[model samples]
Target chain A: MIDAIVLRDAREHWRMLLSWAITAAALISLQLSVYPTVRESSAGLQQFIEQYPEVFKKVFRIEDYTSAPGYLGTELFSLMLPLVFIAVGAAWGSGFTAEEEEQGTADLLFALPVSRVRVMLAKGAAAFLSLTAVGIVCLGTLAVGTGWVDMSIGWRRLAAGTAVCVALGALFCALGALLGAATGRKGAALGISVGLALALFVLYSLAPLVNTFDAALPYNPFQWTLGSDPLTTAFTPGSVLKPVGVAILALAGAIAVFQRRDLRQL
Target chain B: MTTAPKVTPLRALPPAEPVLEVRGLSKWYGRTHALDALSLTVQPGEVVGFVGPNGAGKSTTLRILMGLVSPSGGTADILGQSALNGSPNVRSAVGYLPGSPALYPRPTSRECLRFLQRVRGIDCRARVAELSARLEVDLEKHIHDLSRGNKQKIALIAALMHSPRLLLLDEPTSGLDPLVQREVERVLREAAADGVGILLSSHVLSEVEALADRVVMLHQGRTVLSAAMADITGRLVQRLTFEFADTAAESWFEGVRGVAAVEAHARHVEVTVNGSQAAALDAAAKHGVIAVHSHEQRLEDVFTELIPERAA
Candidate 1:
């Protein structure tokens, strides 16, 4: 029954699927745009590395960016994942609770034999499925492009990055659902979800730039996304544990808030 | 075709068992109490009209029953289970039409019905067809494209299609045209005949006056009056109008015991009384009666008189 509801929502919201397809295509174009720059600057990059290896390495994950897998994952997962995750989450979340009241269809939904928790869970499942499908499509396209360019694909790193991004997408989707349930307004949910996502991203990014912040900043969800090489000898347990923890916490909060809330006024 | 399922389990229950029971139910939004110690019973085959003014807790009661709203302090039972404790058992057996029937804008009428049918887990295609035919709802248009009256028809279809054992309607006839209203009333009668319990809340008095067996009036989140239609109407005031020959005749009929209100016009004197026609005639004879006409009090009159006015 829950699967039916989720699948039905996906079928109904095929437009979002199309939009993600277009976005993925655009992202693929952007990734390839940087290929010529990397190829042409290799000599200069090598010279810089000789003079200041540590500085160059700190500025960019140079070894990872040289490969097609890293290049795509760098731009897409590191940059595009947050954007796509939030966009999809907001799109799905905008309709979740508020639409019931906004369209006055809540009375119809609540009058069904389904529980409120089931309703929220079903919608969250739909969002997760859609976001995961988009993530897979994006990663799959990048893998195929890497093969086309004759570059060795980092299957391990790609899988890890994609997994983390998928989780983050699911986390944001839950956040959107939570916001929707709390406000009972679509615009409010979108505003709060996107605003929080941006604020977290800024804190995670700029926190490392500050000299005093290195020890205090590793737990931020933003800090985990900065690294391009997802699978490596240097990949610490903290990188995997922190973002995953935040994602789990976010999802749990959304479900808890949604379960007890009254679904009236529609 | 041979049918093996002779008696559906739901149908085996006795008629005396209420499909819905609400007791001492109260809900407060912050400091403002929305429903206060409200209690009511709706048995099978009863059409109870829940009447009240704006902000009178009629909608709140229905919402609580539908499990859309939770009560602060009380209990409600639906089909033997606590209504607020679990996913409302009442929902499957109950069909609810809200005061404002807002539907999905993107889906066409056919698509909307299919969605609702899926949610309800019932194959309601034939039922939908039957109701649309009776209610004269056009199915090709999208919900947003339809007028307010037409949107109401789609909602009505969704609510009625399941052939639910109980119906909860809030202002069900606000936007409906008169012909559609008649059809809805007829459908309600048929549903009642089939042993369905219905609780209807509306400001439209004539629908209640015409269809309800019993009327329950609420005021400020509490039930103020509840009685059978027969009894209420019998107790209701009837206006008696008789034209007098001259002005001197008014003094002779000034303080008759049965007359509750009397208004003396230039040509005719109108008197409102609660009892026998013989007594009304006896009072009218003193005024030298020329013509006599009487109109029984409508539900509107009873409602207007019974509900105290809000203080300025």
Candidate 2:
């Protein structure tokens, strides 16, 4: 019964998930197509990267820009891939959870014997799975693309970076679900979650240049995702743990509000 | 147009136990009170009509019983459990059809029914087929393409497939044609005969009078009247008009028993009857009446008579 909600959502939105996976693979192939040029002029590019502000290099996780892990991390996972994952997660999270209320179907859904908490969790799970699918597809593309470009970004490193992206996306998914349930308005939920994600991303990007934000970076979700250079370094337990804990908190808050609120739309 | 007996003769009856009970149930949306200390009860095997005008707290009461909305203050019990936060099991025993029920447009009626059936942990393919056939529902059609009546049939099927112990229907026949309305009524009657308690809410007094064993009336969020259908028909004052063959005169029917007032003009005489109109009709016969007309007592008329200050 619980799976029924999740399954129906997946069936309804499989096309969205498939399109995102194709886009992620396309981006990876498009980026790797240029890796050979970077490798040919490694020393010159290394110097060019060093001339960037020390803060910018650190923010990009670019100690060795000529290497496959370094090149891919700076190009994709640093900004592009994380944004993709976050968008996918947020889209599914907000749209799926709030649609029943927005479309005036909550009267039918909530009238069932199922509890609201279960419905909330089911939607969160479906969104998380969509993000996970995109992450895996992105990882597969990166694995093959690095080899075709004559580089060795280790498989474990690729997995680590993708894991971080997925975890970050999951956190955003829970946040989107929370907003959707709290407001019962899909547009508002998606707008606020995306707005908040973009704001936090900007802060994370600029934090290295601003010493004042140094203390907060340790707790920031975006920081947890890429701050340690997961593609070049090992993925630590804390990397996934922090975002997961916050996701749980967000989901708990969502369930608490959703269970008690009156279905105003109906 | 219903011609059901105004008062049915008494027959041996089964013992009764109320499946729904409410006391002082009040709901306030901010400062606007929707239900004002309303009280009601529906016993097993009884079809109790919850009749009122639009915005008369009928929908609010039903929503509270379904636990879709909570009351500001009061107690409501459905099937022996508190209706405020009734559990899944409590709801499982009760089937509910919301007024203007919301359904997913993407799924065919069959798909929608399967999903709901799976949620209830039951396989209802046969019942689905049967109910769809009985209601003339197009199971293969997508809900978005279905007409309003067809969509309503889908919702009705969902409400009845589980064979629940109690049925809480809000304006169940609002959009139905006469033919389909009669079919739904027949289905409800059959369910009631199986000892199911039914609370049917509608603004149409005639519909309730024809089907309900008892009727409760609401006005401005408060219960203004509650009684058996027979008692309601008997207690209500009605008007009758008699057309004369010759000159219309107030004198011929004067002082007739049960005739409260008479106004005459042209070839017709209008009489207000307090109880039996037999005496007045007898007088009209002697006066060579050519035609007779009974002014039906609509639900709105009842509201005007019972709560003139507020209803006006």
Candidate 3:
């Protein structure tokens, strides 16, 4: 296990990984605990939701707040859950190579017998595993919450939604790794990662306001992950496959660039 | 009465195969030339000291041999395998300490050693313990909390624990105190005795003179000189101070065959002899030399003369 870079990374970053998992679990639990309160005041809450602006409701995906999946989607998975996963993915990807180079440790690492491609793959595996861990924590909390609240939410649908979240998280993680490998600078990688994430999210959120962007919804990662509201809509292969495919392409490009480029010191 | 024995001409023997061989290695970083057709070899059980100023390509040469960087031209081989490809089997036989080694800051020294051991596929727990004990390194201390000297000890242990066939050390004693440096020198000598070929790059000329079997000097990314330690010793200048019965004119020694430079005072004369001291002493005796004293040449002086630009 120590020989594999992925396991090594996990061992080194266990504290951060655990913190992310706990954060995801805590957020999900808090959102689920408020379900009964929201249900009891459904009539008044529906009145308040109706008064919300049309664009605001569209951006937040607010529809039938009394429904379990809809409530969870808005309160948990929609923004908060994906945000947690995105941050985790971006951090892992950037820290893998960029942080090592910045800290002057790349020379020690690259001097080993292992090829650079293998090292990059190991880092990608670690990031994927960490993101999956956070997704699992969120899924487990949602499952337990449903049982505690006696909600009629299907476990199968919850599992499917969590899978989509993992894929979406992986896309951003790959993006961060690509930028880090190309630039060898943690700040640049992370800044571009967060900026792109925000830009794609805004583009997807305001798609209804612009006809051209609405037509380009298929190209937006945010639309791929949040467009269908995985909890309420039927699972589509395109939703998961497109993001996963894009992630693979990004990772391939990263590996190629890293292979040819010289490793620089801080 | 004794008679001189008959002398016979000696025949040159074939050269032995080198444990490490580099040929015409060149590295260019855009418009900058880091190394220019540098070639060298280290035979088994030999320690070759690489001496140069900063940016003189000592680190670049070592890095290329370790496969950390690719050369723009030429090839490097260790144990008959190309270092550029750096197969695992080939790398497992090599121990390298970079100019500035960086270990994981979070792990203890022991953990880092264990991780490297696993990576290298060496089952030498006893060796690790022995190296740590010899180096006086506390294995349980976190790397970030350790002093620079202690950190250097850990790096040294990691490089030596594997007992590799070839050791590529760059400034191995940079942060070490005198005692630790002596200890490390002892370890290197022991490794050499056991037939490990070592290529040590350092700016410390005295250490190089003390430990190297051969010295290779680099200047401005080029090999300025490569000579056996004995040859260097033979060519080393000797400073001769003479007190003549009478004032000796500097011109009296100006035409001496072995004297490189001469200085004359009212009653004392000093001459730097690069060849036989006998030749210079013979010339000084003609000036009615009353007394003579000689000082052995220092490697620092030789280094300055070899790389005069650096001295400037």
Candidate 4:
């Protein structure tokens, strides 16, 4: 049985976790329901899409509006799903440390006999578990929506895409955790996590338009998550491995920083 | 000097191994000194009162002992284990109540206690129930809805539930009502009787005087006084007020060997005596003293006398 901080964190966040999972499910279902209509209007939609600037279409991952995966990728995975996960991840990560310190609860927490590393690891595990739950919910909802829409999307592809989403979410969650550990301030953690995610998104989007940025695409976190188009491509180990590796590194960094720094109560 | 009150432990016990020890413990935040080369020890079953004004490193020392903050130099030990690198076994034997405890808002007091019980890996339900009843805390009430005193009671219950060997309490009676304060004091006494070592920090001098076997007074991040309760009491100055037939000059009492301070009004004078009062009384009697009233020195007065700059 998980003890102490992990169990306490999970209990505290039960409602927020449920809400995030439900929101993910709702957003995925709502977008997938519109897929058939988008396919029906593809000819008209393609003409409208052509009028969109090349950079905008590329930024939004607008390609083959008739295909199930392509349409879902553009409408749901490209922005909406990532945004939801980022928000959830950032909120959980920041709350794990920074918010506790801000509210003066860290004093009570650190007073326990457990080591700081153990506490940090427990909180990290809780955040990862929450993001994983949201990802699983999203995959289940996506499968249900596909069945309802009479779409022939493979379960394997959806699983692969969801895996990519989880990895991406974990990456940003780790970013938030790192900032939370470093700053011991919730506002700074949230701001830096969201700001970094947005900056990476913008950088990845502009890579094709600008040669200078295109050269940096391989190293970009946004590219690692969606650049391979997980819905269409076969599962490539590197695609998932890179983000997972980085997420692990970030979490490790968070643990190290938290262990060394004083547990400040705001 | 007028005789200071003879202070003694409310309950006497044989000396035992130190349950809490700090040797040359120092902490610095950049250029500001939080704790200087401070050292102290708490023996088993002893209550050591940690006294200091605001920003006087009392909290810093407690934080260091709890392993919530790293020290710049020196070592702190609890039960012979390094406190700076605390372990579950070590922490499980220790109970701490922060100066300003903030429990999770979402949980009811019952739920919060349950969580702490699980975290501490102790079956403390009976103890929790007993403590909650004693402290008059409503366990069913959500912590967010409770008043500060009620919340403090919940924290006190949590800290005491496990019956740990050592209790590091920071302002334990703060924000509590007099009734609750008395209850807490009783609990501390009971815990000490159980051979639990306690290091308590508070702004309340009377609380310290009542409970501490030894009083360690800190000023500006350093220990100014560390003595047995009796010694601290013996150092306290007596305050004497005299109403004289004729107005007396302040210098008359000042000339007395034991008089520490003298204030003269129109027909009345107040004298603070450090040792024997005979010389001061004789001086007042020579001025046609009509009536003389003497007051035992309070702990607060002693604290101010020790830390004069703070008084100023």
Candidate 5:
């Protein structure tokens, strides 16, 4: 069973989550509505895609842009979907315990019968669940939109793509919360998490253009989630293992740090 | 699942371990000493008044017991368990009210209390309603909509609603009006009757004087005084000012047994007495004193007199 604290957090911040969901749903609907037009103009797209340099094609993963998987990957799964979920993770996770301390509610909060580790873990879980809810909304929108757009891509691939977003979201969520738990500063948590996420995105984006960055792609988190290309290729549990492991490590660090440190005096 | 490390129980012994106990507790932040070798204990059903001026480490001591802040040294035992790394079960048996209740404004008072009740895995609805009525708090209003005093009242309700065996309250009624403070005092008295041990810290010594069975005064993170309420009050002197119908003479109170001194000018007489005011008071009445006003010694007066000698 989920901790009541998780439900409390979700209830407290549902408006933010709903806004994120509406944006994701709207973006996906607008993207899918153009797939039929792109597929009908495939002959012109092939010549148009060929005129670009191989560097441009490789950097953007612009292969078979007229196809269902490529159209979805280039426009949806690769950047927008993952980034939206990462935003969800970062926003919800950055305030795990730091917000309570800063707002002076920590006195009443820690005064309860719950352990510090339990509260930290519950908040982390709540952040993950919020991101997962957004991912579900994306999945549901994609599943329904596929039928309308006449895209042959199956729902399993959509689920696999969304699961990748969820796993990647968990890693950033854990990192955001770890910063909050260790520093007791929400700004540090939010700024550093979003900054680190953008840095990772830029590094992964330039890997194909820069030889040195290409060498580090094996270690890049974007490689572990998006680099697998779940939409066009086979989806396997092995793809998520690395990101899940890193997420667990970050969460464990958060729990250990929060459990022993003296809270803000307030 | 991995098993946790085991340790032996604490060594020092008490005949009957108190609900809350602290021995030689100290906390230092960088170069500043927040607490230094302070000690206290509260037995079941006992109301211990924790009194001190600002920076006396009174709030620090309570925070240490509540496990919000860690002590640099010594032990704080709650329900016979160590407070430093006590299990959450210890918190279940304790209720704590901070000097100020800093709550988020988005939620109503009822919502905030309900969130806490859910976390504690207990149903405090009945207790919440009862406390709200007694304290005259509006549970329906948002926390920000309430005044500071009303917020304090809601906080008091949250702390007391769970009915814990032990309570640590720091300036529980600081922002409350006299009427509300009286209501809070009534609630605390009733809690004590149910065998709840309370460690109450306050700058308002008069409120402590009204309710505490034992009073502990802290000075510079040290216990300066600890005694029964009767013991300290016994040694304190009382002064009386009288408005007389006719001219009074200082010689009239000269032979009064308990009268320490007397001054009479025109129709006004002031007499100082130790212990009982009966003998000196009767002596002044015989001298045509029409109206009398007796002033009891305040803790601040006693504290001020002690600080000059003790701080050194």
Candidate 6:
């Protein structure tokens, strides 16, 4: 039953999938066209990397930037993935309950034969499917883009990074669902989702500068996207645990809130 | 010849133990009491009309029953289940159509209905088709593209498709066109006749008069009056206008037992009185009721009187 609801939601929100595909295609095409020239100027690139290590590190992890798979994995999966997930989460959060109320569908939805928890669960499942699909497209696009650069890809590292990206996306998805269940207003839910993600991003970027927060790196899902090693090594359970745990907890909280909330509006 | 399978009589069918029993239900939003000790019982196959004005607590009561909103002070059982007991089973057996109908516009009508049906564990294509045809809903249209009335029709189909034992409909006809409205009314009546317990809320007096056997009037969230339509109407005073035997004859009815008021003119006397025409006839006979004409108070008049003008 949960799967059915999720699948139905995906089919209903297929427009999101189409939009994600278009963006991913454009990004992959741009990378394939530009990265070859950058890689050929190894000495210049090395000098540039040395000249502004912080900027290089900020954009792409310099240690793994030599291999096209490594560079794209960090730059695309790490930085770009979060942005995509945040956009998706924002859309899901605002559209979930608020749209129903705004359109007057919430009233009819709550009146149905299914429980509110089940409805939220279905919505979460659909969002998860969408976010996962986005991650897959990201991974696939990068893999094809790697071929264009004549770079041999390390499958293990890409998979680990993609998994973490998907997990963090799921976290946002769950939060978005919770925000949706909390209120019937679209702008409010959207603000909460976007605001929370932006704050987290700021905290993450400034973490190295904050002396007190330096010790909390392991707990952050953002660190998981900064790929360490691939092909030769599998992902560490330690790095994956936090995102998986947070996603699970967020989903549970969403269900809890949904069960008791009036949802009388839609 | 072999006996055909016999269907049980509607009345003989046992009441599905009051899925929702509203008792002394009262709700107050801040200083205003939206529902004032309103109570009603919904038995299987009984379609009860909850009629009241805009501010009446019809929506509040339904919201409480669905566990969407908590009542300030009241108890209700949904399919013999209570929210306190942690039972979601009531939802499984219930189908509701709120005063306002809304759905996820991203899906086509078919997708929305199919999702609802799957969750309810009912293969309801036939049921959906039945209601769709009756409501004249275009299932192929994307919900976003559909008009308000069409959206309501979709909601009605969704609610009825599952064939729930208890249905709570609030202003189900508000957005529907007259033809579609009649179709919805017919469907509701048929559902009741088929033994589905229904509680319908509407301020459209004529619709209520057509669809409900009993009317429960809510005033300030409290049930001001609830009775079989005939009984309430029977008890209310009717207006009696007669060409008085003489203009002076109106004064003679001032002290009559059943006559509450009399307005006399040169050619006619209009007397408002309680009870049957026999009482008025008997009283007027004494004064030579030469051309007595009577108009019984309708359900609308009784409804108006029961709920104070300001409260309504």
Question: What does candidate 3's lDDT look like per residue over B178-210, in tens digits?
Answer: 988988999999999998899999887888888
* Candidate 4, B88-184: lDDT as tens digits: 5567678889888999999899988887776655577998889988898889999999999999888888889988889999999999889989999
Q: Write the per-residue lDDT of candidate 1 for residues A84-163, one digit (tens) a residue.
A: 76677666866777777777788877677777766776777777778778777767776666556555557666666666
Tens-digit lDDT string for candidate 5 (B267-311) = 888888998888887887777678998888877677776666555
Candidate 3, residue B189: how far the Cα is off, in Å: 1.4
**Candidate 5: pairs in clash:** none
**TM-scores of the first chain across all predictions?**
0.81, 0.94, 0.96, 0.94, 0.96, 0.86
Q: What value of lDDT does candidate 6 attain over all alpha carbons? A: 0.71
Note the residue pairs that clash in candidate 3. Answer: none
The C-alpha TM-scores of every prediction are 0.89, 0.92, 0.92, 0.90, 0.89, 0.88
Among all candidates shown, the one with the greatest lDDT: 5
Docking quality (DockQ) for each candidate: 0.40, 0.45, 0.28, 0.41, 0.39, 0.46
lDDT of 6 by residue, A101-190 (tens): 677766665555455666676677678778778878877776677766776666566667666767767777667767776776677777
Report backbone clashes per prediction. Answer: 0, 0, 0, 4, 0, 11
Reference-based lDDT, residue B270, model 5: 86
CA lDDT of B24 in candidate 5? 90
Q: Model 3's DockQ?
A: 0.28
lDDT of 1 by residue, B85-197 (tens): 64544567779888887887887999888877776666879989899999998898888899988988898888889898889988787799999999999999999899888
Error of 3 at A76 (Å): 1.3
Q: What is the C-alpha RMSD of each candidate to the true structure, in Å?
A: 4.1, 6.2, 8.3, 6.9, 4.2, 5.0
Predicted model with the maximum DockQ: 6
Compared with the true structure, the alpha-carbon lDDT of candidate 2 equals 0.82
Quantify how close model 2 is to the true structure by its C-alpha RMSD in Å.
Answer: 6.2
Query: Which portions of model 5 show Cα errors greater than 4 Å?
Result: B1-16, B240-273, B276-293, B307-312
Better of 1 and 5 by lDDT: 5
